[model samples]
Target: MNALLFIVCVIIWGSTWIGITFQVGHVEPVVAVAWRFSIAVVCIGLWMLATRRSFRMPAHMHVKALSVGLILYTLDYSFLYAAQQYIVSALLAVLSSSVIYFTVLFRRVFLNKPLRREVLVGATLGLLGIVLIFSPEFTQMTAQQGLVLGLLFALVSFVSAAIGNILSENMLDEGVPVMQMNFYAMGYGLFFMYGYGFMSGASFTYPDHLEFTLALLYLALFGSVLAFGAYMKLLQRIGSDKSTYVVLVYPIVALGLSTLFEGYQWTLAAVFGVILVLIGNAIAMGKLNRQLKIS
Candidate 1:
């Protein structure tokens, strides 16, 4: 079940980059984010109501859940969308993978948990692999001020994502069910997105294009709801240190899909990158040592 959840998140979230591509031209990204979470929140809320799951929570828990949603769904996504305007998604994918290390560092700071050496080493290799995989894209880039802004946005987005991951673990530890927490958090995230949109004077430009609408729905349902649900469940089973290695993996999937649909040519470096990421995952999961002993 844990492995299944991890794979679900990896594939679904990886594919979501395509959906986000559609979201770019239709509306201001802030408005698009608002729409995405609003759809997720409503759909999830209706499901809970129909299934007779209680929405009632202690006031303090609601606050906690909302804050998690705000950071994870709102701030992380807001900055993430903004970053893409300045940099290619390949670069963003590589940058966002830093969430693994961020989560590791934050866990030690917030939970006072000893750092896991295996996870860090694995993450390091995975990060290196990603850079290699995207080396062609990186070399094609010319330096500009917008690149700096993109990097800054990506950093903030990833940090917010790492914080959200830890907070979700803490929330799960508090005994809130995963779906319910997701429901509330998405709800709060939608609120924040909407509030930010208005405050920033972002006009809510709704595109009537079928592709845009389809992409938005996909992002709301599969990307936000299904992927996130699976991910949070995986986080419960594996520690964040290990679970977030999915970040390294999902981008590979993204590139693979791009190869099919967008004619992305894979280089030899990309092949090595994939191998390293797989080996890193094995090391992190302790599979490498076991296999070595068996051999």
Candidate 2:
């Protein structure tokens, strides 16, 4: 079940970059994100109602849920959407994986979890892979201030997401159902983004093409609903330290898509980097050459 959830999440989120790409010119990034989450909230809410899931939140938990929602959806996504304007999607995808390290840091600092040496090694190799992936962009860094800023914003977004994941994991430990938590969190996040859109004078113009429309739906449904649902489930089952490794795998999926659709050339460096990434993930998972030894 965990493997299935992980694969589903990777495939769905991997394809979401195409959807996000189509959203480039239609409306303000935050406004588009707000609409996506708004639709997601409604869809998930209806499903919850149909399933007869309880909507009640404990007094202490509501605040934490809202706080996590704001950081995860509103703040992180706002920066991400804005950063896409300046950076290549592939670079952003790679940089986003750094969340694994931040998740580890938060775990060690607040949760008193020990930082496994394997995780640190994985993080180092993964970061090196990101550098290789974005080496061309970095060459032009002096001329591309916006790109530099975009990378910074992407890192900021990553940190916010990592923090939110840890918080959500804690909440789940306290007995919160993932779906119910998402519904309320998404609702609050939608409101937060809506307010930001209004303040920024973002327009509500819809895209004209069917491609964009379908992409928007895909992002709202599969990306936001299914992917996030699976992710939160993994967080609950495996804990944040392991769950954050999903971020590491997502770039590989994104790179595959880029190769297929965007004609992205995979050089020798990219292949080596990918190997490092896979090895890093294996090391972090502590599954390096280990088979199930049943007595």
Candidate 3:
């Protein structure tokens, strides 16, 4: 079950990079993200209603949803969409795996969980693999204006996402229902996105292109709802630290799609990077069959 969830998440999220790229030109990135969550919230809300899931939650849980909405949905995605304008989505996807380290650090500091050596080492190698995978893009950095800023925004997005990951894990540990949490969190996320759009004076134009339309629907339905559902379940099954190994694997998928869409070419370094990522995944999650059964 855990393995299935991990695969589902990786495949969907990896494809979302290409979908986000299609969104780059049609609408303001902030508004595009806002629209994506708007659609996602409605779907989740309907699904919750159909299943008879109660929407009731304590005040603190609402607060948690708000925090997640602001940091994860609003900031993380807002910056991510913006950064795609300045860099290819594959590079941004690769950069995102850094969240593993941040998640681990926050878990250690806030939750008082001791850092496990093997996970850390595995994550380090995974990060290294992603860098090597995108090393060719880095070489062009000298000629790319705003590349540094784009990279900075991507970093901010990853950190915000990592913080949100920790918060969600805590919420799950406290017995918060996943579907209910996502519905409320996405609602608040949509609210924050609208707030940000108004404050920034970003135009709220709807996209009419076929690619953008398809991308928006896919992002909302599969990327936002299904992918997150599977991922959160993985968090429930395996701990957050290990579930994040999916991050390492999905960027490779992003790059694979990039080959066709973004003109990304595979190189010797990239091949070696893939090999390292596989090794790291093995090291990090090698005991998953045992751990899942034990848990």
Best by lDDT: 1
List lDDT for all candidates, in order: 0.86, 0.82, 0.84
Model 1: per-residue lDDT, tens digit, 79-173?
A: 99888888886688788778988999998999777787788878888989999999998888787668888899889899999999888888887
CA RMSD of each candidate after superposition: 2.1, 3.0, 3.1
Q: Of the candidates shown, which would achieve the greatest TM-score relative to the real structure?
A: 1
Clash pairs, model 3 backbone:
none
Count steric clashes of candidate 3: 0
**Alpha-carbon deviation at 54 in model 3, angstroms:** 1.6
TM-score of each: 0.95, 0.91, 0.92
How does candidate 2 fare on TM-score? 0.91
Q: Which scores better on lDDT, 1 or 3?
A: 1
TM-score of model 3 vs. true structure: 0.92
The true-versus-predicted C-alpha distance at residue 196 of model 2, in Å, is 1.4
Task: Report clashes for each candidate as comma-separated counts.
Answer: 0, 0, 0
Backbone collision tally, model 2 = 0
Model 1 steric clash pairs: none
